[model samples]
Each structure stands twice: as structure tokens, then as C-alpha cells.
Target: MAQSRTTEHCVQMPAHGAGQGKTAAPTPEKQLNCFVRCIALIERLGNALGTLAFTWATVVLLGGYPTALSSKDFRYATAIVSLEAARMFSRNNRLDYQLLFRTRGAVRPLGWNGLTVIVPAAIIRIVLASLRLGSHSYYGDDGHLDKRNPGDKTNLVPSLNIFYGMVLGQGALYIAACMLDIFSFIPQRSLARQGGYADDDRLLRKISGQALTMLAMDSVNNCLTMLRETGYVFIKELTSIIRVDRYRCVAASLLRSMCLHAQQELEESDQRELSYALREVLERTLIADGAELEIFIGLSSQICKVIPEDLAKELEDSHIKQRFVMRLVDVLNSYTEPSPHCPGIRRVILEQAINMMEHDSRYTNCFIDRHMAEALSMVEETVSEAENYSLFLGDVGLMEAREPLSSLMARAKQLLAVR
Candidate 1:
């Protein structure tokens, strides 16, 4: 897995719609979890600060700002912009982090997501309150100490009180104290009352333009990770992938995994979307130049052989399986020679193709037209006295044929010839 260094620290979102009631008090585990949330919030804050600093310094030194904008205006603009950008980036790229920490361990207890949000929110409000209190310092108590904008509001920062910030973060305590104080009196309320309690959430990253552009690029690097988890994303890198010898089996294993998954959900209608996705995987790997990706000249052939009958029944009944059969037939038709060291790759595909055609008239015609007579006869002629191919994960080789590949091929040929 080509994981980023930050991947290890990736936190997962909480489960959706958890009916479990919130625990009354933080347990030892919960407290430790609280610490973790705090750390994550701190990490996020540090990144934001760095972005703000870089944004401010670059504009000030490199003269990126317009002549009308004061230094302070540019700094505040960057601050506001950076915060919004960071939050948006974090929200959008959550899927990437989720893909990395994909195991069950990624899911924290219910309400942890609430912590992710609440922790950052709580800290920011507290820091704001503290800054607001200090903004009125006598030594620096200029009229513009709070604001001089056309609509600058007073009580912009409440007193440095945790309870006030914890509850009324966006609201000020004494609006009459400042110019826009009247509107600050418009109070807001919500269900949460406990100090640090937070609940249901799902989202998960950052850096800027030029520099921001670089940061954005850095955060959007889930493509490589997706190739590990999703189908077909890695084919773009197939040239590099095939060079690594062990990756051959790894690629084959993906096909096997997709096959078993389709079989498990063969009867479910809702799975049509997923079935089609798997079908593409089979086609790209099996029907189209599947020979080059072979681990042992017949790796795809093994998966093709193990393809079950439920896949071959009816297109309406199982689209994915039907597609599986269709691709396997193409594979059989494309066969040049059977695996010299192993017999099952071509042999199993040939056998299953015959079985499916006999069982389903829909497929029989397709097979007879596509690969039934020509390909079957070609492989059948190469059938040996020893061609027992049991498709197992362990010992991936053609098993000793107690009854001979030629005999099995004879029966398959007879079944097709009669049809």
C-alpha cells in the first residue's frame, strides 16, 4: 500500500445512526479518546496557523495584495480564507483517509465524530475568547481596538470564560458593550448541554494556492490508495505492476476475490451495480490480454475455471455471472496453448464453458457461435492423460489426473458435438 506518512494518524468517522445512548461520564478509555481528539485538533490548528502565516507573509513580502488593502486587511483576509479552505478540504478529502484506515479499527465508538468537531470548535472559541479579552487591553485600548469597519460589531469576543464559549460560541455575552452589540443579543440554542459532549459525524485534510496548490495536490493523493481498494484504477500502472514478480499473484488474487464476491451475491438484485463493476474486472483481466498478467501462464485461467454455474444461469437472473461466462468464453477462444506445466487453466475453462452451455440455452448459442466448436476442439486435442486441476489457493498447479484430461475432454466434446 503506497500510504502517505500521515495515513497512520488518520482517524475514522463514527458509525452512522448508532442507537446507543451516550455514556454518562467519560470512562478511562473515553478520557484517553478525548486526549486523542485534542491531539487531532491541535494538529489541525497548527496546520491552519502555518497556512495563515505563509499566506500572510507571501502576500506582504511578494506584494500579492492590491494597493487599497492594508497589511492588517490582507492578514485577516488570509486568516478567514485559510480557515474556510482548510475546513472544506478536510470535509472533501475524508474519503481518502477513510480508504486508508479501512479496517474495522478505523471506526471509533459512537459520538467520537462529535468529538472531532466539538473539540476543534471548543478550542477555537476558547482561544477566541482569550484573544477577545486581551484585545481590550488598556495599553493598546485604541477606539479601533475592537473594530472600525462600517459594520464592526462590539462584544466580538466574550469574556475569557469556558462555559460561555462552550455553549454560546458564535454569540457574545454583552452585546451593548460594542457597536454591533444589538444583533449579538439574538440568541441561539441547541440540544447539547454537557461541556465536551459531541456526537454523530462523518468527514475527514490541507496546504494552499501556488503553495496552496501544492497543499491541495498533497491532500488529494487518494488515487493510489483507491487502486488498492477499488477495481480498475490500477490498470493505468499495469506496466510497472507486471514487472514486480509477486504482484502477479496479487493481481490474480483480486480476480479470485471479485469472482467469489459475485457468487455470494448472485441472487441479489440490488447487487447489479456491483456485479457490473466486477464484470469489467473480469473482462479487462481475462478476455483482454489476460495472458501478460499471468503469474504462472494460467493464473487467470485458474480463476476462469473456478467460475461457478450460478454465474452462467440467466442474464436476467445474474448479469454479473452471465458476463463472467461471456468473458470466460472469450478467454477460451483466445487460448493459444494449454499451460505446459499445469493442465487446469485451459482445461477447467473448457469444461465449465461446456457445462454452462448445456445448462443454459441462452449461453449455448453464444458459445457455439463464439468459441464452442473451434476453441474446445483445439484444447481438447491437447488434453493429456494427466490433467486433474483442482483450483485451490494452496499448491496452485495441475493435479495428477487419475482419470486423464483426455477422457474428461472426450465427455465435454461429446456434449458439445451432440448439441
Candidate 2:
């Protein structure tokens, strides 16, 4: 009887322990999951606070709130806040396969909705601030009309402040959107694995379209702002701004974006109209000599990769070919002394010229006949006596240059034979 009682006690104790063990196992897991949720909540709250703070600061500074800060300080603060906001929005609202695939159009605005509110609000604040400044200037600080004359300097200060604030705010938003668009190309592994080429192409087109749309909106905003500020002088001021070399960089970026869109369309549709549009943009861009020229060169290199046949045919136009060849010769002439930035551009131009030549015998014949002498002259100037002799004696850079030129010459000769 004692043994039986001892066995029963032992079995009951184990069952009780087993029940406790089962109860204890899930407690740690539950605690871990709760902790993770808390951390996520804190992170989200922190982001919200940061974004709110940035938006408030932008409004206050651009709105010209009465503060100890000078105009310069206000300008700097506005710029900094704008950049930070851009960085934040870009981080949160990335353009990726996940965004393109998972989300429906109805819910898409929620991703970047904050930006829509913030940008317009800032613009309105600036306009109201300008109105207040104008009112104060006209009515005097004491609220009575001042006998003092409103000089040009008096009017100019407020206008300048308003113009700068609006431009800075709009520019920041544009930069952020651009950054988002550029990064949208990063492939999401899960989406990519499930999707096909057709899906990827669709995503690319959507991204490109969005980028173009943003560019258009920015251009229109700038034009409208200029018109509002300068009134009748808007056209003159707009022309002057467009003429600036820095502004040409913007145009180049716009052109590059357009080219990317055209390239995509060409791939999908293989339409001659797209090719012609690309040719027209390229022709206009090539005519401009400035930072734009470098951009056009880069664009041409990209075009060579995508639309070589179409581009070659476009170059076969006598006027276009002549202008392009002359530009190449000028670029070569600049590279005669071998500057730091020249070699890379020179190589691309040469490669593009070679591609054109390879694509069409007629273009090769025209290019070699019209520009070969200029190229040889530039090459002779570039290759010094020691470098020339070292070619037979095997100098690295000289040998590298010789090989491409020789290959180009060989291609030209072959084209001439075929002609």
C-alpha cells in the first residue's frame, strides 16, 4: 500500500509540473512579440514627430514669423528644412516594385500625402507673408500711412525675399520627388521573383511617366512664379534664366528624362515617331555649347546603346551630320592637351562616332571624309615625340590611344570599300 501511494504521488507531481511548463513556455514568446510591437510603435511615433517638426519649422521661417533671426538666417533655415524634408519623404515613400505592385491607385496618395499638403501650405504661407510685408510697407509700422516715399529699394527687398522663399521651397520639393523617382528603379526581391518581364516594363514606364510629370509641374510652377513676380518682365526674366549655364543643366536633365521615356516607348512600340522625337531633342541639345554639351554627349552614349540604328539614320542628315562632326572635332581639339575631364568625354565621342560609322556606310564615309583630317591633326598634337616613339617601344597610354584610333581607321576603310 505504501509503494502504490508513492507511485501515484510521483505521477501526479509530474503531471502538475508538465502543466506549469506548458503555461510558462508561451509567456516569453508573448513578451517578445509585445516588446517588438512597442519598438515599432516608438519608431513610427518618432518619425511622425520629426516630420511634423520639420513642416512647422518650414512654415514659420518661410512665413516670416517675428523672430530674432535675420533674413539670411531665415533663408538658411528654410533650405536646411527643405533638404531634410526631402530626405525624409524619399526614405519613407520609395518608388519600388512593392509600391507599384502591392498598392492600388486609390491608396497610393497615402504614401506621399504629407508632401502634397506641406508644399502647397508652404507656398500659401509665403504668399501671405509677402502680402503682409507689402501691407506693412505701405501702411507704415504704426498702422498709419507713412509720408515716406516707397523707393525701388523698398519694393525690391520684399519681392526678392518672396521670390527666394517660393523658389527654395518648390525646388526642395522637386528635388525630393526626383530622388524618389531615381531610386524607384531598385528592384524588390519578392515582387521581382513573382513578376515577369512584362511586369518590370510596366513598372519602368510608370516610373518614367511620373518623373516626366514631376518635371513638367516644376517647370510650370517656376514659369508661373516668375510671371507673378516680374509681371510684364516675366518673358525677359524667363529668357535670361534659361540662358544661364546652370539653367541649361536643368534643361539637360529634362532632356535626359525625355530621352529615357522615348527610349522606353521605342522599345515597346518601335515607332518611328518616337525615334524622330528623340532625334529632334538631340539635335536641339547638340546645338547648345555649355554644360548642356557634356550632357548631350552622355545622352548620345546612352542612345548608342538603345537606338543605334535610329540614331545612325538621324545622323545621316547632312546638316545634322555636319554639325555633329564639327562638334566632335571641337571636342577633340579641346582634348589636344589632355585635361582631366576631357579623356572620358573624348572616349565616349569616339566610341559614338565609331558606332555611327559601323551602323551606316554612308555616315562613315561622310564622317571620315569631313572630319578625319581634323581628328588626325588633334591626334598628332596629342601624341608627343616620346609618346609616339614609346608606341613602337610600348607606352601604356599611348598604346591605348593608338589601338582605338587604328580600329576606327580600319572601320572607316572598310566602310569606304563597301561604299
Candidate 3:
């Protein structure tokens, strides 16, 4: 759906790759005297990337795998890319501009009233590196006071305590900055702008709230999956996966929401903007550098859902429905990721396709198009394999009486066959 999450946040390089305007054209006085443009550009880069790094870490290190896919991740990444984008972050109270500037964005503000924030952080880090505080100082490899000569008065290296404190401080500031990114969201005012009334704002809030809630639920569920009761954990996991679908259902609902919202509520300009935003959200959530099968399955299900019906008669959707579905079908035809662990996606991808065919003539045409037949067959195999794996576990000492994979798989297969 998107080339990268960081696209929105890209730093404005001075005359290199940024500012395509006549007024922005560099002058000899601006260049030779103080390097003002260069300094400002560096400051902007430092603020954007430095601040966003904390938020990005909260996603990848703290949240799900392929963390770049989430809207939350994009939200932060966009901030990191540019100062103009950063303005958007602060425009709707999406971020605390003051607390943020004091932390990662500047660390220590400088220049004419916070025009450049990189000065203090850049200076401190530079000084630390020069002192070689945590490096090969006079104390040698271990940096122990005991190993150093008492008579060596020339040893001007900083104490290990000071070095450790500096290192720890860096980490502390990062965590604090991460707190800002973690709490930020697509709040009601983020979408509510000129020409958008109270009702529109309320609707936007509702939609945003629902999307955010779903994402939070997924995050909680991902965390929950890590925990297992003492015994029969393997069988329990398999059984749980049998009656499941997560992302597919989410994508379906979101697609439905986006189309309906665009059709009913927005003006032409607002409609395009809102639709694009939703698509980007979809792209950010589903498409990825390390795209998961579950996401693609979710996407595929929604494609099946979207193609069959005209949810918005006048609302023209761009790229989301058509291109991605073709890509999804192609990917599914070649999808090699293990389905035994995340069987929910395998179940729903087929189910959505099957369900769509029953009501829509267009869906019937879609049923036999492209490489869908092969994709469906592959999905069916995954279901069969997952069922077998679950049964094998049950057959072993890891048995559970209320087993569901067998019956579930049969029903799925029956439905698939009927389609």
C-alpha cells in the first residue's frame, strides 16, 4: 500500500533534495558567511529523526514484529521525517510541543528561541566522544580505578561513574521521548479541520476510536499469546487457532467503514483526503517490509469484500481496491509462511472469498480470475495441514477433550467446496 512508513517524515535537505521553489534558491551570502541553511537543515534532521526514533523503538522493540505496518508506527515515522510534518503532529494537539522539545527533539534548545535544537545534544555527544569517557581511557579495557596508577596525575579521563551516568541518561531521555510517541493518536481534531463541522468531527472521532481500539486489542492479544498455562500449551494454541480470524475481519470492517464514510459524509476534497488517509492507514497496517501472511489474508478478504459491491457510488477509491488485490492474489499463490501457528488468517481468507461469491455476480467472475484458484488451493492445504498438526498434538500426551480443529476444518472445507 505504501513504499515506506518513513516517507511522510523525510527531512528537508538544503538544495539537495528539498524545497523546489524560487525563494528557497540558495544564495552565496547565505552559504559562505555562517552556513545558516546547513545548520538549520541539520537541526531539523536531528529534531525529526532523534525525536521519532524513540517512538519507532516503542513500536518495533516494544510492540509487534514488522512494526512498521501499524498506523501508530506511521504516525511517529511521519514526525521523524520532517519539521513540517512535525508541525502537523503538534497542530491538532497530537503531541506536546514543549515537553517534546525539552526531551528528544532538542535535549537542549539553542539558537534564536528554539530555531535549532541539535546544538546541545550534538555538543554533549561530541564532548563525550572527545573525552573517551566510556572508551579506551587511561584506566584501560576494564576502566577500573584500581587498575589506574595513583601517581598518574596526567590522567584527565572522566570517571566510570560519570560515563555510566551519561550513557544511562541517554537511555532515560529516549524512554521519556518514547512516552510522548506512545500516547499520541489520531484524535478527533486531527481529522476535523476547515469545512468539517461538529458532526463530522464526532464521526471522525468514532471511526478513529474504533480503529485505535482494534489495534490496541490486537497488541494486547499478541502479548497474551506469549503466555501459556502450565500443561497442554501446544494443543491449547492449536485449538484456539481453529475458530479464528483476526486481521481479515479487521480489514473487512475498515474497508467497509472507509467506503461508507467517504460516500455519505465528506465533501469532494475531504472525501479524497479522508479516503487517502484510510488507504494509507490500511497500507501502513497491512503492507510491510516483512509483510505477514495474516495481514495479506486480511487484505485478501477485504479485497473480496470490496470488489463485489459498490459501497460508494460517487466516491472514487484510488489504488487501494484494485492494485493491492492483484498483488495479494499473486502473493497468496506464492505465500510460503507457516499457517499452523496463525491458522486464523488461513481460515478467513477463503471464507471471505466464498461468502462474496454467493451474493455478487462480480464476485463470481472474480472467483475464477487471475491466480485465485491456486491461491485458494494453497490456503486449503494450509487448513488441512494445520488440522493434521492439531490432531497429532491431541493424539500425543498433550490431549484436550474439547478439541475443535477437526470439526472446524471439516466445516471450512465443506464451505470451501460449496463455493
Using TM-score, give the best candidate's number.
2
Q: Could you tell which candidate, 2 or 3, scores higher by lDDT?
A: 2
lDDT of 3 by residue, 115-222 (tens): 233234334433443344334344444444453554442322333223323333443343443343333322223323321434643333233222221222212221
Cα lDDT tens digits, model 2, 147-264, are 3864322333444355444444444444343334233444322223333233544433332222222222213322232223333342222223234442333333433433344344
Residue 419 of model 3 has an lDDT of 37
Computed on alpha carbons, the lDDT of every model, listed in order, comes to 0.36, 0.41, 0.34
Q: Tell me the lDDT of candidate 1.
A: 0.36
Estimate candidate 3's alpha-carbon lDDT, on a 0 to 1 scale.
0.34
Worst 10 residues of 3 by lDDT: 1-10
Candidate order (lDDT): 2, 1, 3
Give the clashing pairs for model 1: 90-205, 114-199, 208-211, 208-212, 208-213, 209-212, 209-213
RMSD of each: 23.1, 28.4, 19.8
Candidate 1, residue 105: the lDDT equals 19
Specify the highest-lDDT model's number: 2
| C-alpha positional error of residue 362 in candidate 1 after TM-score superposition, expressed in Å | 2.1
> Model 1: per-residue lDDT, tens digit, 1-419?
11111111112222333346875443332333333333223333434443444454345422432433334434443544454355436554332223112212122221345335434643553454455344443112244443455232233222112222322332121111121111211210011112222432211110000111111122323323323333433333322333344233333333333333333322243234233333333444443343332322233332333443423432445445545556666666655555533334565565556556556556566666555567667776655432454321123332233445666567666666655
TM-score of 3: 0.27
